[model samples]
Target: MTVTATKFTPEVMLSAPRRSPGVPNPSGKLVLYTIRVLDIESGNSELLTEDPEAGCPVWVGEEKVLYLKTDSRGNTTFIVRSVKSPEPESYDIGKINAPLSDLKVKKLPSGNIALACSALVNPDGELVNPETDKKPLSSAKVYTSLFVRHWDTWNSDRKRSIFYGALGEEDGKLVLLGNTLTNALGGTNLSSPVPPFGDSADFDIGPSGLVFVAKDPELDPATYTKTDLYFIPLKTFTEPQAPAPRIIKTPGLEGYSQTPVFSHCGTKVAFTRMHSRQYESDKTRLILVPDINNPDVTEEFYATEDGAGGWDSRPEAIAWGLDDSHLYVSAEFHGRRMLFQLPSTPSKATQFPKLIETPKGSVVGFSVLHRPGSETTVTTADILFVSSTSLIDNSCYSIAHPGTLECRLISSTSKEGKSFGLSRSQVDSIWFSGAGDYDVHAWVVRPSTFSKDSKKKYPLAMLIHGGPQGAWNDSWSTRWNPAVFAEQGYVVVCPNPTGSTGYGQDFEDAITGNWGGRPYQDLVRCFEWIEQNMPEVDTDRAVALGASYGGFMINWIQGQPLGRKFKALVCHDGVFSTLNQWATEELFFPIHDFEGTLYENRAAYEKWDPARFANEWATPELIIHSELDYRLPVTEGLAAFNVLQAKKVPSKLLVFPDENHWVLKPENSLVWHREVLGWINKYSGVEEEQKSN
Candidate 1:
């Protein structure tokens, strides 16, 4: 029996199964990944462990795996299970005293496993347990420096630090060597797996030692993006005392450092670096340390000239090839996040990395797979990657060979969208001449029911992406998804204008100091191009929506001549007044984008201040802000709402007290989608269209 498909709604998207990146075992024949163990050859998957709380599985060897299991009381335990046996062994490392996650394991020379995970720790380097720890006499926090608040959370005494200890068997039971884990950054006044968004990816464990990225303690976190690599040499997990970590400095690369991936040999490290100290969106240059023993020697792979002379796209997450002769890098190219292969060592002959084609989607995550004892041989290796499109949630594939670039499918979650009536054919793209004679790109997602022969006109949902530096890639996103708007009988258009990534460094830099200039002009051109080229779109019933920088642009557009073209607008956590942006925690972002500090660059802020032209905001707008969004702050939304109310403009305000810069919680997100869609539908005549039908 064939069941008719239903409209793709927020509920379907939110209920989709979330799959983690695949981690291949030592032999590459089996995968201990996500929540299930997959047999690569047989194409069979089974539950990794019976315990529901056990997750973040890391391969201990060919047949054994180690994972973390946290109870309802917030107490975490390390569990090691074997594929051959149903019973798993539990290890009691004593009271970690805090919630721990992101488990990583490395084999020690002493035939024991060295385990590491990130945990929130107090000043004295002890794990912080809010459940059992003593409560403060008063709810008060004093700040002497910057970073009083960041992202969504206010400053606290506890820091997210890496805790490590040795795992060995004793008296027929698994136990931590010291019965307690050692804080790697203890007494250093620094945090690893840096706050807000960092995870196990920020650090890597290898045979030689542990290398992690951390911001300089001397500098103010609120104003700088200078995160340096720190290395701690641990020859064996049985060290009596935790050694002091030393900084691995890259002379010219002074910006943010990320994804310090240690080579298979563990003697070297390859990571991405940005040159500009203040610019967060600068080009991420690939950097390599020849030897961890000698930290001073570093080389730049695929080296490009300072400003536009060489290869230009930013390299994201990286992994070492099987033979260590090459590196696999996933980066944004045009509209998709493509994977590329580059030499592990610096090559003067190579101008650009070789692109390795995969499925039609962004390469979200990838790892190199090698057969056991075949690390030195290049023939027995493959690249396992996770790909996803705007329509497909995620699909796992393995590139059989780098030479052939043959991608063999392993598994996929794409079938889950079938019942929701989604298809890849609904997604397309268009390029138009934008400001500064640059060709700007925009994605066009048509409704599932749309047909060229129908003569039906769909309302326009102009989605302006955030980051101003970020692009609307052909990737799956739970937030600001074009498909959701398309399902509501609208033609969703997402533009990658000036200051968007994956294009080039110069194009992205064009909007640094000219926030309301080139980008705005490009957006205007995008709208005009849509009207002129797309016959199926209803320009008269259009709505604009954005968040963060996009939200700021929406507010900016509210006071511009373009505001009259759209029937309504939606701004999520946008900036109201450029002068009051100092209230943001990341001062470096505004400093770099606006050209200077608020006090020193008042003219620049005043030039793009949306508050200055609030009188011109006549378009009916829906403003959404979260109380925890320290990046823009709720006050920004309230300020915009107050102005709209004062001017007697038709507007509505939706506030989420628990959400941050983005609506992350599933329930809250559902509400967000409903309210946003309802507001846009009411103005775009969708509500009227439904009633008339």
Candidate 2:
């Protein structure tokens, strides 16, 4: 009998990575997140919190834990109590009426406490009344953002939704960052907005107020994206007085404003931006702003760099050693994601990022990785990352030792484990011929157990990625379903053709207006490669699969001269007409907008639309889409399906009721996999002996 690992199991019981380890209290012992109390330990850990469902936790003292609890009022009431000293007694000291993100707690050098939280929807950062259901108090109305999930992965300790951003300039002459946020009033008291680059999520400050800032990204109208840095001045804000911040500005920053960050020594600041292809990153530049808080005199914009730039290299994670000798920043260059080491001295070129981890095994290289530096250096670490492996689904690592940057497995929803699994892939790379003599690249995986002695050529499947610029990266794809197929005796291949990124910017640009031509050749070439190189792959029985842009490609391929090569095609939420796509509510990705707009690029749109070529289609196809998909809305799939059905082609359309661009939730994902499998089996003939074996 075919054996699937009994069933799926999650790996850890801890909270999500987006939620951070609670900041340690002054004595350096206690840490709390949610309802539970946490204690620092030296080795591998076990959950220590006593209360269940206690979401946000923080360390208050060596013997105490402070956590946020929603008292029917909807306000997150902060409670501090002794976890070690006996009776489990705790006191409710205060609460923030405003919704918050990246809540932080730290013991001050003076033995007092520093609490920092950001408010997004309401500027006044008013706390929510869970009991009364009152809205946040703010003059500026918050945008009912539909793109919230895309921009943030933060969870709130209270009713207000939370978002994370990096730090920016202006602190008490010292540098520091801890999850920075848009205060309820959308105003940061002292620091500027996060710069344009770097990624931020649920965050917490360092122990005893030593940690100070969080690096976030914001746009610079002049330069595009600049990393804006921010921090809470715990030492100064410890008084009864609320924080009073001085507004600071840099050279060329007269007009544009966005994400920002600060350097370790408090001497420099960095920023990032998402620029149209027109503005490529040059180098990391440092602009000096007057230290108005300092008695030192005159200062105008003196643009200078220690030569080690903070440019193109968008700063994601900023790690400052206890002594401030080593600095770490995460950056993506070429096809590999890496970490760069910035020396305490300005003269040295920022050292290239040392690779900590990749999809699986030894990451031959990386496309993106984020590591947060700390006084703990190689030992203590917190990292949030997106890998070709993780695909845009961000993953995290807590207590990431520089020794092993891999994060700890923790899911906020459950205390259960086994959420992630490591699977083995056999093909390093597969090559195949296209329309002409051109070639395509693909990676193939066989079922967990296979034998050359067996005569059965397995049923085959292909996975197509969206971005005409997006290429298939080697990573764990919860949706890719290759492993699940392999578990069911099907061989899987994912191809990266001419239009994909990671290969190079030029390769990506090549398909800008030529989507229907050369890129199509690459897809065909990949299939041929599978037929020729993968002897175990049944050439006659295969399926064409893709989503989003890939979905568009699949429909376009059906009308190609060699369209009948595959008997089955699976199109998942793809675009059928450039005209309809342009008219949709979806906000196009930056590069897509830059190439051309609907009005100006109409000719290219017509040439790229598969709907025009639908008459040439002859193969059977299956369509899957989300009713709420605005990106490559359901209309595209509907149009293609209608034409196919009208033409009398065997075609079917499946719509997910409550999903979007991507399907979420564990149970939904499981069903999705099953649906795709059933589609393949119903259309492509699976050998009976193969299923039994």
Leading candidate by TM-score = 1
**What are the runs in model 1 whose C-alpha is more than 4 Å off?**
1-5, 49-52, 84-95, 169-175, 304-309, 379-381, 385-389, 394-400
* 1-693 per-residue lDDT for model 2 (tens digits): 112234222211111232332343444333343343444443222344455434556555456555556544445555555665345666655554533334555444444454555433433543344456555576443434322222112122232322222222233111123322223212442222231221223223332121122222242122233322233333433333324332343333322222233333444433332323222322233222223233122222212344233343333334443334444555444333445444434444344345544333112111112223334444224332311223222232223334465644322211211232223433355666655554556666666556677886887777777876666654344566455565556777877776665454455556766778778877767776667777888868877788887888888888886568787888888877776764344234422533566677677678777888777988988888887675566677788888889999988888887787787666667666667767777666754454665
**Cα lDDT over the full model 2:** 0.49
Count the clashes in each prediction: 1, 95
| Residue 651 lDDT in candidate 2 | 85
How do the residues 544-639 of candidate 1 rate in per-residue lDDT, one tens digit apiece? Answer: 999999999999999999999999999999999988889999899999999999888889999998998898999999999999899998999999
- Residue range with the least summed lDDT across 10 consecutive positions in model 1: 385-394
TM-score to native of every candidate shown? 0.95, 0.68
| lDDT score at residue 629, model 1, on the 0-100 scale | 93
Using alpha carbons, what is the TM-score of model 1?
0.95
lDDT of 1 at 77: 78
